[model samples]
Target: MATLLHLDSSAFHEPSVSREVTAIFRKEWEDRHPGGTVIYRDLAKEPLPHLTADGIVSALAPVDSHTPEQAAAAALRSELADELERADAVLIGTPMYNFTIPSTLKAWLDQVIIVGRTAGEGGSVAGKPTTVVAARGGGYGPGTPRESFEFVTTYLEKVLTGMLSLDVDFIIPELTLAKSQPQMAPLIDAAEASRAQAEQDAVQKAKTLAERFAA
Candidate 1:
């Protein structure tokens, strides 16, 4: 059975655009692949500890009789990396916060993107497909006011692609905060429609990759 790793990093619980969109993607994916298993990681709920000096030392330290804290930190790193190795697909849920991703999500990335694990000299995560459900309060597309720059989408795509060799796909739900946009009902409807279309697109993309590999 295929394994899908779902990660949600939005701090805004129910009103979170990223969370809602990702839920749609997950449901549709499950519907399409009955036996697929999904592993959920909620960064907001379970935050990873910030890297400490000792932790950094431990990370650079050789694997030996390490302290309990060091061992635990190391284990967390290894576990996160292992999850990537095990996953057939990864779904990332993120919302722009001040033109960047939530700190919690970046922290998680720091944990998993280890040298010689997620990427390194010995072929790390060379072929994985990752889908990102990204949403913003305002428009972030070309020619928009806030579109001048945002590092969240571009950075994630670049880092994930380079570190994991992941075929990245992104769904950007823009203009949610636009006054010209419709009311709550229509806004929700539009978001739902965008999510539906993105889900189909992601599945087709992954299926095509799978077919190519199988061939």
Candidate 2:
């Protein structure tokens, strides 16, 4: 049976574009694989602790020499990384905050990025398909004035691909604040279009990956 590791880090539940988009993708995936497993984590609700120096040192040193605190941290890191290693596909939903991903999501990344374990040659999860839904309040696509400030996708692309060697793709719903912010009122139509396209992409991508895994 296929396993999917799904993560959502949006603080807002009711009106979060990233959460909504990710939900669409998850539903499609679940529908296609009734017996499949989905390992879900809501980072906003149950935040992971920021990676400590001890956690990093524990990975480098022998496990038998770990202090109690280092051992605990190491265990947590291993557990988190194991989820990724077990997954056939991975999904991350993170709304942009101040032009970057949420701290909760970053913490999750830090905990799971064990250099010798998950971030190097012959890593357990290398080449896994990772879909990231990066919802943003404003447009930051290429050629946009804010494109230079788009750290969410740029940073994640490097980390997910360069560090973990995962095959990464992104589904972005931009201009999420169009309806809420009066200054963005004129962009409501454009925002809706982006949302619609993102939802469509999610469903299609999820279905394709589901079939690929089921094969």
Instruction: Summarize candidate 2's per-residue lDDT along 191-215 as a digit string, tens digits.
Output: 9999999999999999999999994
Q: What TM-score fits each model?
A: 0.83, 0.98
RMSD of 1: 3.5
Q: How far does residue 123 in candidate 2 sit from its true spot (Å)? A: 1.5
Residue pairs with backbone overlap in model 1 = none
Off by over 4 Å in 1: 179-215
Q: Give Cα-based local distance difference scores for all models.
A: 0.75, 0.95
Scored by lDDT, the top model is 2
Model 1, 1-215: lDDT tens digits are 67778999988787776887788767766766667678899999998877665556667788796788888888888888888888888889998888889889988888887776677645467767788988876646777566677778888988888776777888787545543455544466555566566566655655654444341
Best by TM-score: 2
After best superposition, candidate 1 residue 175: deviation in angstroms?
Answer: 1.5
Candidate 1 has its poorest 10 consecutive residues by lDDT at 206-215
